[model samples]
Target: GATPSIDRFDPDLTIRGLLEIWRRNASLKD
Candidate 1:
């Protein structure tokens, strides 16, 4: 099988990573 994505590793880590992405997205919208 193929390697899993970040969220597949751990829920907590996925949430933190997702928050970072959201912040990046917000900045891009500015």
Candidate 2:
């Protein structure tokens, strides 16, 4: 079986990383 990425074990960090990526994308649309 394949192992999941570390982010799956640390949801807060995953959410934060996602938010950061979303912010960058939002800024790019401006």
TM-score of candidate 1 versus the correct structure, residues matched by position: 0.63
lDDT of 1: 0.80
Off by over 4 Å in 2: 1-3, 6-8
| lDDT (Cα, tens digit) per residue for candidate 1, span 1-30 | 434665367888878878999999999999
In order of listing, the candidates' clash counts read 0, 0
What C-alpha lDDT do the candidate models reach, one value each? 0.80, 0.80
> Candidate 2, TM-score vs. the true structure?
0.74
Ten contiguous residues minimizing lDDT sum, candidate 2: 1-10
